[model samples]
Target: MTALDSFAPAWQIAEAVKSGTVRAEDVTRDALDRIKSLNPKVNAFTDVTAERALTEARRVDAERDAGKKLGPLAGAPIAAKNLFDIAGVTTRAGSKINRDLPAAAEDAELLKRLHAAGAVLLGALNMGEYAYDFTGENAHDGACRNPHDTTRMAGGSSSGSGSAVAAGLAPLTLGSDTNGSIRVPSSFCGVFGLKPTYGRLTRHGTFPFCDSLDHLGPLARSVRDLALSYDVMQGPDPRDHACADRPADPTFETLTDGVAGIKIARLGGFFSTDGMPEAASAVQSVAKALDTTGTVEVEGVEAGRAAAFIITNCESARLHLPNLKTRPDDFDPDTRDRFLAGALLPASWYIRALQVRHWYRENFAKLFQDVDVLLAPATPFPAPLIGQRTIEIRGEEILTRPNIGLFTQPISAIGLPVCTVPVFNSGMPIAVQVISAPWREDLCLRVAAHLESEGIVAAQPPSHL
Candidate 1:
């Protein structure tokens, strides 16, 4: 294995730094080298803050020697989705309209926590323009390619975060999930992603695509690393009204307890019907490994997904109306027309969608009363070929790539805590969404650990790097 493959987790890296076996400067230097060599091919990063990373590493190393308390993630390297503000950096939510926007005055709150935890910010990663789409095809900043297969798409708007982690550009990356941004990319790129429950983390300083439904989250290679980041980033931020005062999540440190006796179900109906067969097989392996029985039915998914669309399009239109109206030419042509159209959705639809969201949440709540977790396909198909639209599912033809998350958006619309686990399949990567009740990320990770122990987790690249 290469130096990168044998790379330690963030926590272990901190311990190594503390023990003097590995210097923070050395690790940061190696990380910068890796990004330089790998990121160009992937277009995973918009900028590379090498000078700053090295300076920060030297500072942390000095503080450690002076007996300063090192936070849990100290000296660990991380990448932030471009939407998060880093001092003097433009907070572009991946749009040209914001190209002329001035740099932020302060670090985004989430970035602040990560900095406080001692994580070195490598640079800002690329993403879907204004986070308005899911396919990861950016007109201005080239497409973010899937590392597993360069020609296939890396699901977005967290496109850069997914590609960066998959390509070993960074160990942990922050991504926003207004809908399926975080989970989709994690699934497609064969990484672990968590979309925390609504208000679980601060959105302050993170550019919001939609004021009501936006979410910021982490994407990492391992479940433990992802969970560790989540634990540190969560807490009440009076600055964000949606921010919650909830207690901490059970650290993934305890995930080894396993999912034995954990009641789980494979969602049928909307989840099972009309999607890629490989996707079903991937989830089936996890079910069989966990001794889960046949799929359970989930009704009203179409209605739920429709409601989610209404809410997303309406809110997004309002957020960008000024840009869409004055600088229409500035938007990515791929999503510009859709943005213009969204400007016309009636307020009645948006409000009714919220009502539908409430009803769906209640239904999900009742379903959880019987099952510990619900399992559903993360995408209708494996990451589709770059720019390829039509997909064959079972037998019927469908617009495979963009609508792959038809099922995911609804879950996010209600702000459910979700963890997308990569399923080891032979073709392009596939995964299953394991969703737990609100604020129950612990349950989601425990279930993921069970699948991991059974060898049903992401299929690692052969040791060829």
Candidate 2:
């Protein structure tokens, strides 16, 4: 678990630094070297702040001798999705339009929290343009290849975060999910990703994709590390209006207590049958592995998704009204047309979506009283071919781009907490979503940790490394 130990977890890395067996400088150097050697093939990182990262690492090591009480994540190297603001780095947000903007004057609020924990900021990761798309293809930075298979996409907006962490470029990463950006990539890349409750983590200085739907969370090699990072990142930031003011529970506690006695079920209906055999079967496999007895169908899921669409489009259009008016050409082709479509949505549709949200949330709450966790597919299919627009599932060619969120959108619309547990089959990875009640991030991670411990969900490294 020293800085020299590749197999050790992040907590071990920090403890090793504290114990002097692994210096912060050495660990940071290893991360930088790994980035230099592996990033080209992965295309995960948009920027690698080698000099700044090493400089910070050296400071952390020096502070140890001064007897400063280091934070829990101290010496852990974290590369954030480009959506997070890095001082001296322009928040390009995976867009060509923002390329000319100057670097931020200070670290973003989330960055500050991570830094306070002794975590090192390595650089900015590539993402879907303005985080509006899935399927990890970046017109500007190039596609982020799936670590498990080079030919497949890594799942996106948070695509680079998934690719980077799965490839071990960094042990921890920050990713945003409006629909399935964080969950999809985490599923495809076989990493633990937590899409915290809607307002559990602050979005301050994190580029806004859809004001009502956008959420930021962590991606890590292990469930514990995900909890560790979330521990530091979850809390209110005055700057973010959506940030909740409640205190945060120790994420580690929830994961360690285990998943026994929890009313767990497989969410059927649109969540399961919509295609994603590998992903759906993965859920059943995990449930059997965990001895889950509850199995239920989620009615009105498709309707919930329609409602989510209204909110996402209406909010996204409002957020980008200026750009859609002036520099529409600068957007990624996928999102450009989508934004234009959103710009034309009727105001009444948006209002109805709001009403739907209130109703859906209440209905979802009743389900939670019967079941603690609802297992669903993170992405209906595994990582697709880089440019694929359609996927054949059960004799039907489904729209690949938007279908990625088939199971995820409805759950997100209700602002629930969920975790993606990666399932591998025939050299490919698919993940199941572990959905919990709102603000119940603890329960989601707990179930995911149970699956991980049983070896149902394993984080396998890329071959040929």
lDDT of each: 0.81, 0.84
Candidate 1 residue lDDT tens string, 43-106: 8898777887898899889988898887777788899989999887888878887779898789
lDDT of 1 at 107: 85
Model 2 C-alpha lDDT per residue in residues 1-465, reported as the tens digit of each score: 233645355777888788778889889888888888888988999988888898889888989989988888878889999989898899999999988889987877888998989988899998999888888899988998887887899999899999988888888899999998899999888888899888888888878888888888998888888888888887777678788575676778778788878888887666655445776577778878878756687556777899888888888888888988889888887788888788899999889888888887787788887888888778777889999999988669888888888878888887889888888864787888888888788898998898899888977887765
- Candidate 1: the clashing residue pairs are none
Q: Candidate 2, TM-score vs. the true structure?
A: 0.97
Name the candidate that leads on TM-score: 2
Candidates in order, TM-scores: namely 0.95, 0.97
Give the worst 10-residue stretch by lDDT in candidate 2.
1-10
